[model samples]
Target: MPTALTAPAAGAVPPDASPDVTGSDAALRRYLHGLPGVDAVGLEARAATLGTRSIKTSAKAYALDLAISMIDLTTLEGADTPGKVRSLCAKGANPDPTDRTTPRVAAICVYPDMVPVAREALAGTGIAVASVATAFPAGRAGLEVKLADTREAVAAGADEIDMVIDRGAFLAGRYLQVYEEIRAVREACARPDGSAAHLKVIFENGELATYDNIRRASWLAMLAGAHFIKTSTGKVAVNATLPNTLLMLEAVRDFRAATGRQVGVKPAGGIRTTKDALKYLVVVNETAGEDWLTPEWFRFGASSLLNDLLMQRQKLRTGSYSGPDYVTVD
Candidate 1:
């Protein structure tokens, strides 16, 4: 059995109001089960309503730049090489080499083994190196191996850790086990200064398969110590839809209302164009509100999305559309 870390008192909300869901497994489970359930049709309808927002001219330009800055330019694949990571980092550092006005992306997300390569490549550029850990895309490994994965990334200077939750456990009614894994990964993210690398917990909502499960997983992750609650690993088929992302936005927004500590939201997978990215911004704007607009609070996990944004950005500046050949293949 995994030994328990000293958790906060049960049902105790500290004066700071940070989420204090750490307690006996039974207590935590009760708390999670007691939370209200989600209404799928209502939720999807609301998301569709938010998606109808129209952005234009200067507003479009601002939204475009904001979207660019909020991107977690990603390259998560078995085929990832050092040279590929280096190239990705450079693109993230200075997205538009021809136009200096282009803002750098929020971070460069990669596998644990590639953290050092990305860290070195993005050095002094204020761009963070984020690594996917805890048996990313699938959280099927033992606790020890998962922690080692997180520690290796942190040791390699990963400014952020994106850890996936154990979907199988959650589905099997092992909620406490899922929460405990997130808590353990959170502990592993700690740095020398007592501060820790930002932890983004991927819920794998596609697998969770219901609005209720996504909502439960969001609160569960936040309670366990997720600084950011993400939508997917981008490896699954139903990756990041407008309705799903909106649901997560609502989760973070409500979690803040209940606990003073704010959490971020990242919608990974299949968000390919500037239009799709903008609609998500509309969800954040209309749902999570303006406060969630910054990179610190929200992110889009994508690689090809960057090139699309660049093409659109060029059209905005040059008054002409640019083809795929004009942008870097990263």
Candidate 2:
């Protein structure tokens, strides 16, 4: 069995955190393992620190969630409006209609059903087609169902698959159940040429409050062959949070330290501003370093975030902040 490394205490301050961690690594670890509230990671402090940074550059890249309504076909219909997506992509993926073009976003996420639409719409462009499969939002189905879902999506030409873990099974302590599902999904993603769709496993951290559980979930998912371990599905109330992300990054750090795997990290859901996006980037920087900066390792699954980043980028290029309606979002 693998022994747990000595990390900062639960709800305790990180060594670099403003508030000093209170005890020996072992005690802190135990405290963290048992609780659902704050661990050595000070969420408020981290959020504030990230907020203070000046994000006045066009250097940052983003990934847009065009098809987020997994269960609602009605919403999915307009999720990635080809005209809007084309327009957005043309304008450096700027969500604000008023801004000029710079460069396009790294990828455009959508439902597997809409892959053809996004592919045709974004053809001759660098933007990729990311599909959400395996009964997302509420993955309550069986492996066969999920496998068939995954296989069909990949066959339809999906470059990536963002799968949601079965919350009911995971919450029931069935780690292997969750692990096997991801493994099967990945296998289904592999094409005859041996190439595979990028596999991003959603941990939905807002639902799991304990740092240990988050870390455990990350490791298990990575071990089961997840290319990226994401934060949330954006369907839950308590979506992505800094502390939860910090914990996941620590796992990524540890995983890399032990096995040299360069897994990705994504913080999705409710990140409505450029500031939040920057803070997430800062956390990724602090935890996983510079390697995870690109679209390959990092993606923000947001509908409203791109516009804010665009607006901020525009303000830097131009001279003033745009209005609430300044950005055109459909």
The TM-scores, one per candidate, come to: 0.93, 0.77
lDDT of 1 by residue, 214-270 (tens): 877888888788999999999989889998888888878877876777999999999
Candidate-wise lDDT, in order: 0.87, 0.65
Q: Please, what are the lDDT tens digits per residue for candidate 2 over residues 1-330?
A: 322334444543322211112243344334334333434557556656765665434444332121111111111333456565455444433334453354456666676776776667667766666778888767778889888888877888878888988877776776556766777898899988889898889988877766667776776677678888888888888778877777777767666765666788777787777667777777777777877766677777776666666666666667887755666654
| Residue-pair clashes, model 2 | 8
Every model: Cα RMSD to truth: 4.0, 7.8
For model 1, what is the C-alpha lDDT against the true structure? 0.87
Kindly report which residue stretches of model 1 are placed more than 4 angstroms away from their true locations once superposed: 1-18
